[model samples]
Target: MGQPIFYGSVHVLFYRNDEVLLLKRKNTGFMDGMWSVVAGRIDGAEEVVSAAIREAREEAGVDIDPSGIDVVGVMHRKNTSSEWIDFYLKVKSWKGDIVNKEPHKCEELRWFPLGDLPETVIPYVKSALARNHDRIWFESFGW
Candidate 1:
């Protein structure tokens, strides 16, 4: 038997009033032209929550409180070539204006009503958002 291999990623959902921030993916080979939230893979020697805070700052130019981040959902997603353990965190408080810190990997940063998101959002992200609201703890995709 071979060792099980799965990648871990953190998705930070920043909400302001009734809106949620989304980054338009660009240049990134994985999900080019799709809309996603502030997210990235967990680095070595880093806790999942710490990864969330780092991604929020690196990708969106904001500082999130570690205590303010709540794991709203976790999704086990698998495709033909890869699998991911996605940590969906909701953060209501943060410092600094949200800007596109990684413009090379993203097109624009925009806020949308949480009730209605763009049709071009990555499918799994859309599902994750709904799951978070429904209080569902875990979900599987492309199994």
Candidate 2:
């Protein structure tokens, strides 16, 4: 009889023309071999937008200004053992070149055409991208 806790995370989508950046997960115990966007959990007391900016810089070697990004969608996903609230943000512009800053956790960094994403993309991530501009603010998965 306690309040349910849903962990919060941020996902950053970097766009160039009609393509979007994606990083292949590697060596990470969870979701290894899958492609995903730059993402990480929000630290305590951190604002969601701040977390998205931080994650983009940490994972993609890019600096995103607060005004250059927008929260496009929110996903409530339930996996086998945990629930997650993931905020998907789109980066209109950023500073610095994109790179795989976390080599141990990410295998490759590449851009794919929005209309031709790879089949290996993470399920929830693909869903978010497919609906990024549909004005759908909320989505849920796995019940």
User: Number of the top candidate by TM-score?
Assistant: 2
TM-score of each: 0.93, 0.95
lDDT of 1 at 78: 92
Return the top candidate by lDDT. Answer: 2
**Residue-level lDDT tens digits of model 1 in 1-143:** 85768999999988888888899999878889999999999998999889999999899888988887788888999967888999999885888998889989999999999898999999999888776453538899888
List, residue by residue over 1-143, the lDDT tens digit for candidate 2.
Answer: 84677999999988899999999998889899999999999999999999999999899898988999988899999988888999998888899999889999999999999999999999999988889463648999888
What's model 2's overall lDDT? Answer: 0.91
Q: Which stretches of candidate 2 lie over 4 Å from their true place?
A: 1-3, 134-136
Relative to the true structure, candidate 2 reaches a TM of 0.95
